[model samples]
Target: MKKVILFAVVLFGALIKAQDKTDSQFKYLEYDIEKIQNLYRNNKVTVKEVVEAYFKRINDIDKNGIQLNSVITTNPDAIKIADSLDHLDSKFKNKPLFGIPVLLKDNIDTHDKMPNTAGSLALKNSFPLQDSYLVKKLRDAGAVIIGKTNLSEWANFRGEKSTSGWSGLGGLTKNPYILNRNTCGSSAGSGAAISSNLGIIAIGTETNGSIVCPSSFNGIVGLKPTVGLISRQGIIPISSSQDTPGPMARTVKDIAISLGTMAGEDKNDKKTIGNTPFLHKDYTQFLTLTGLKGKRFGYVKGITKGANKKVDDLFLQTLKILEAQGATIVEIEKDWISPEISKNSFELMVSEFKDDLNDYLKSLGKNAAIKNIDELIAFNKNNKEELQYFGQEYLEISAKSNGKKDKNYKKAVTIAQKGSQQGIDSVIKKYNLDAIIAPTTAEAWKTDLKNGDNYENFYSSSSPAAIAGYPSITLPMGYINELPIGISFFAGKWEEGKLINMAYTFEQINPQRKVPQFLKE
Candidate 1:
């Protein structure tokens, strides 16, 4: 017994020593927004060096030290892109994200040499013919396209019992702060990679809580802009009404900058019309630490009755911070809002997912996997590893849906729009609130492949914003254990500027963002 105890103690000590060494080896792992900016300003780090550091980190931690499985494929043109950016910077450093390395969730199309596979082998070697509007914007801003990150296969829309971050092509993307914990879907890799310092920032697409949930789980900032604020063109779609790509970054400022660059009208997406006014060429102008003053936030504490005690406590602490920051807090009345509309949003998603996805697949040209909803159902049945972990119960449910024409779907949509919009718009009109505040979700629970997600109470605060075609942003408030919980601020359609100001205010007052320490037991 003494010998066994002695061996255990020695082994534990060795493990601690090794972890310290690993942590020290990566100096740029936990860089702040200003620190990286300063490094760029002073020429202490070249674009090539920064991109190379991330690549080396990916090679070491992603494939070696931790085997995070966060990335699907490294960009073949990364070095060339970096070199070209260096020359451009030498002549004129006009680009905002000049030389900064950014990762893409596999669902976002890139016309580069790298293929955009949404973590499915079904799209292997199937590169799109054109760059997404967001991709073009990133290039224009002089950002380096580093690699594609792993995601929940088909963006977590395919299955009911699906794992949040698992992809057959790229495997599971482990949370950087805690290896055993989940990185939440469907933008799991984008969140995990940013949290792990694998990239400066990443872009993620959301239909429902895809961006915000993963951001909350991974302890980062996720911006789910107004439906038409960012173009859905070239993005693998779940719902055209709900699907919009936005930035995931370690800081609100970084997220703002990326969003500003990415927001614009696209010929491919007609819905983006009249978005030019919302697209600020300089979103950084709104980032002020003192912006929290005189702001009104609608607190949805009613949703927290059944939440985790630890998460609730953290949330209360966040409320205190907001109060101290000179913001007005008002409790949401139960009668003003109900859960019925939130439930109906999912029904609308199911019907739209079928129709919207088929159109997207057809746009992908020949040699693409399953071109329509029926074909997708068949393909999932054929692929065991991809479909086995999570049965396509939702897809099957969606298959039964009659696109947009079903009377049931129409009723669901009408109820959703009326119920959610009435609840939100009435409150906003009555109180004249700048934004409504609520928890993005309860802190992420442990990942369970066998049983699926353990979602507690999340107010579905985003549903009103999503259905209303408005904007929402989730920022890390505090943590429950090592897991991060986020506070969301939402506003009505075309009110992105107001939402950004409010979110920026809260972010400045509460700078509780921290790098996760991955402690292995």
Candidate 2:
């Protein structure tokens, strides 16, 4: 009888401990960087303690309870880094993100022991020869690099019909709001991690919709800055003309903070050599609750109308709020990019993928697999697990192309540039618009490996911005069922500062974000 009583007591104790841990883990899942910073300043929490708590939660829930699979590899050096930051002199306290933990989507290069695998087994143990420019900037700014997060293998550029966010190395990243829903593609982990509070913020790169799509699905703010605003030096490339790194976070203010730190010139990246003066040192100042006052924003009505009735209603609510705040709303009936431009974007990506990837591999020295595109295709064919889900149809198509020498490629580039500039830019100018607004994307759809990306009617916001290399930001507006949706604001070329200002204002006025309750009792 005594043994039975002792067993019952032990079991009860274990259950209580489990419950406590679970509750604690989910406590700050919705807290922003500012709230945590204030807490840390008041001695309510230590950086080291916060870092440890998040790591524990990630281990327990990320791939276990919720099975989100958002994180690719947790940094073993994270605790040490946080401890070092915590003990820094009082002067470091002023740093907006000092001791804040951040995650990087796996494709970004990290010089640490972590693998820059891009969610592929091809580079399973391969590490970068050097840190990516953005990673270097984050570490220098006193932010603790928490971990590498999962992504679509090869940034969803390998195959024609590849599944977004699924890779042989890290598996699929599930949306936090609903465990069964998709987290979208490419920079999938960045969105899921930030939305679920696995980290304060994350860095995600995009050739097209990778950052915004995942951000929309996960209900966070994602900013794809002017292509040259943030250096893409060490990142794996798709199209140098289009690929750029940006911030993904739960709020617009956090995104601004991240972009401020990362925007600048790098000696290694010639594209940013003359762009340092444009980077903002303090972005929080742009967060005026009344920023929407008197600003004329164009509504790309065509794309915003495609989301389900519920989503459209939510977007309409947001539009109404903007109007009430004294912002002028204008409907744009004819600003669509030509289909020819779209075709060009794809062609340019293919041409650059072959050249840029080969260049990157060569820079990897000895750790890289299959130096050129041909070798990579051959390697994938031989490795079933890495290439089984989707064949390298894009790669095969790219391989057959004449590369940069094709006249068709040249014409496509011209068309894309003109359509993005003359078409989208002219419309913004004609309307005297501060920004162009449209639906970022629809709600998260169910993931189907048997099929491909469940892409429905996403606004073609990415094209004009991407081709023009302009700045664009997307913020969560509302949810459909439990799956969240978002709307985007596109700023004219090299106008990230203005874009951030407007986005911050909108976020302050109408904060629609919330924490995900994945394992509620």
Candidate 3:
């Protein structure tokens, strides 16, 4: 009788202990960087405890509950790093991103146990020889890299009609807002993960609309910095001129904090050589309540109208708010880049991709899974899964090209740069405007495998900035049927400071960010 009573008592105590442990882990869950840091300072939590909470949340919401499928593979060394961080006094000193957890888009290389697959089965087990330049910056600033997130395979440069978030190695990543809706590539995972609070912040690479489009779809903030602002040395490329890694987070302040750490000179990448003068040591210094008070913004009447009424209506409402905030909005209809110039810029991307991808593959050394584009195309032909959804028509076209050696490559570069760069500069200078504002893109599309990426109106202004290698920011404007739409603020080169101040002001005056419920269709 006594033995039975003792067993019952012990079991009851054990259950109570487990409950307390769970509560401790969750007390600081779903917090932003500032809040998390405050919790750490108050001795309310440790870095390891916070990391464990994120892991639990990821497993519950991402892997099983709603099945977000955002994370590709988590780092084995995350907990160990957290432990090391906790051992120090003045944990926040000199570490701007001290103990913050981040998720990286799969293409960015990390030399750790985690493979930088870029969502291809051919390179599923491919580990980078060294950390990418930005990854090194993150680690140095004391941010813990938790995992690599799924991206559009080859950063969505693979197929003629490629599905955004579908990859051969890491299957489909579902939209957190509505499970069936698409998360735009190739930063799809970073955007979705940040939306679902899988990590406090995420880093995603962009060539054109990759950062802003996903951010708009997922209800987050993303910044595509001036091309030379961040290093492109270690990142897998789409176009050397257009490709840039940017930050995405729930709040504009968080991205500002991250950008400060990410920007610097990369000796290997020549674009960043003379970039020191343009770089700001602390981007958060620009955030102010009255940033947009004296600024002039340009908008086109035809761009956001007549497509989807809800998106247009929301954009119209946004304009009223900007006007009320002491800023003047100007009409600049028919001022954007022409179709022919845009087409030529695209051809340049195709030309650059072959040389860039081959260079990256060769850097992987002797034991890489796929040697070059030829091997990748051959592998795709043999593998059923790689060709299951879409045909690799883009790869075939790129493979036959002579890259920069071709007669038209230099001409294409000149036309693309001259048209895009001048297009933005002329407009900004003509009207004496601070920046250009437009709808980021149409709302999230339904994820379809048979027919890929059908859009309603498909309005986007990312190309001008992208082709020009300029800076742009996208933040949540409003939602249509529980789907988020974003508004963009873009300007000529090295205007990131002014852009951040403007975006922060807009977000502050009228914040529309909403948390995803992971609803099923």
Candidate 4:
């Protein structure tokens, strides 16, 4: 017994020493996907080395240094998968995302060991039978499925006053820019992780501000594509009308590449069937440094005014840059989007959440922790940790909803679709615009569990496009006291190409993106 104990102690000490050495070796490795691929091709590094480096980085930063808690789980088989890819034929290595490590928001399904929990304790043990449609596409493109990320429980739709990045299963994901500030949800982990260089790329879903808001706060590029562009078949549900997965990354070029890999029609999702005309297998083809020239853009000044003064000043500079590039700017009125549309959209989400969530639970098979929302609510009530910060008020409200058959629900859907679509269409027609521009969201607010989100009258440009099922892209604009802000470009349905071009041009001209300093209060 004494001899065995001595051997165990020595082995554990060796493991700790090795981990410290690995962390120090790769602490400053560059995270650009193209650069990493070139190194692999030159035989200067292997896929396994990259995977191991990322794992070491995650351990150092996410698990220990700042305790970001951004990553919910890391793939145990990532090194093995990378080794297999490294051995593939040279011709096969030419894939768009060859050996690139990618992270998925927890709501996305994967048949691997990780659970699709959506940051909820109730579904912590549930495992899906297959990968999401986009996941399969990503795998086919030779991207490595790194792991799942933390999010707001149930994608921030669970309660009225809940905190953004706090989850029962994974805890709170802190903003990498400033430790005490919030990383907005429901794509919280994806934004923070990507900003901190934990992974090369990550996939995040947005019902409204989930992707863009977090991206804005964390200083990254987030693209919420038109609803049907990426199939939502295997993802845990929110509202079927507005839920879509998007790419969140550090560069527009990287986002363009990832968008191409994930955009396609899926047999399980009927909404994607007729979207072939808008789908592009190589979206990077449209990226140009001169894309802003000769393009007419509508500036939505109302929603852009109330944010930080530094952000506002930066936005004005951005407009000047566009004008210098020979792009026309049309100023738009404040009341572009109707109040009725906002009201109806909220009502629609309430009704759809019940129907969609129940269906998703049924799809999880009989082994799910909680079968439905009612059970989920009960589980939370019994588990104090789930309700330590906020109650499941939204879940309670959704459970009481008259599933999809209500006349009000139908009316709300029609009005929401009509209002949002017309609101964007009219502006484009009036200004002969390629897209509309606005600030993506407010600056990173202080994480306040007691008082909830510090944004009392927060106005986002994401809502109109989200409601219309249109594409919108947010890129880093500038900083306010080291906290990042973002500018958004959105357009009519299936106008992803236009938005991408405009955003890429803006990125090339300004190039203001900054890495996080991990400052603590």
Per-residue alpha-carbon lDDT of candidate 2 for residues 244-318, written as tens digits (9 for 90 to 100): 999999888888787888889888777688886777777767776656899999975545444355556777788
* TM-score of each candidate structure, all chains considered together: 0.92, 0.92, 0.94, 0.94
lDDT of each: 0.76, 0.78, 0.83, 0.83
Ten-residue segment with the worst summed lDDT in candidate 2? 1-10
Clashes of 1: 0
Single out the weakest 10-residue window by summed lDDT for candidate 4. Answer: 1-10
lDDT of 4 by residue, 1-521 (tens): 00000000011111111122433466434367788788888998889988888888888889986688999999888899999999999998889999899999999999888889999888888899888889999999999988889998899887766788888999999998878788988899999999988899999998888888899989999999999999998898788888899999999999999999999999898879999997899999879876789989888664445534555677788889889999998988777788888778878888988988888888888887778888988998999988888887778877988868767998999899788999999988987988899877767777888866654445466788888888999999888667788999988888888788889988998897987877765
**After TM-score superposition, what is the CA distance of residue 401 in candidate 3 from its true location, in Å?**
0.3
lDDT (C-alpha) at residue 75 in model 2: 91
The residue pairs that clash in candidate 1, if any, are none
lDDT of 2 at 145: 90
Instruction: List model 1 lDDT by residue over 1-521, tens digit each.
Output: 00000000011111121133555678787775557767877889777887888899888878887787888889989988888777763545656777778899999889878887777777777688789888998888878899998998888877666778987788888887667677887888889889888998999988777888889878998988888888888888777666888899988878877777888888779889887876777787777665567877777664556545555677778878888988888776656656677667778878888888778778778877657778767766787877667777777888898888767888877787677767788898788787788877765556667876654333334566666566789988887655677888887777766666777777776776887776553
Q: If both were scored by lDDT, which would come out higher, candidate 1 or candidate 4?
A: 4
| Preferred candidate (lDDT higher): 2 or 3 | 3
Q: List clashing residue pairs in candidate 2.
A: none
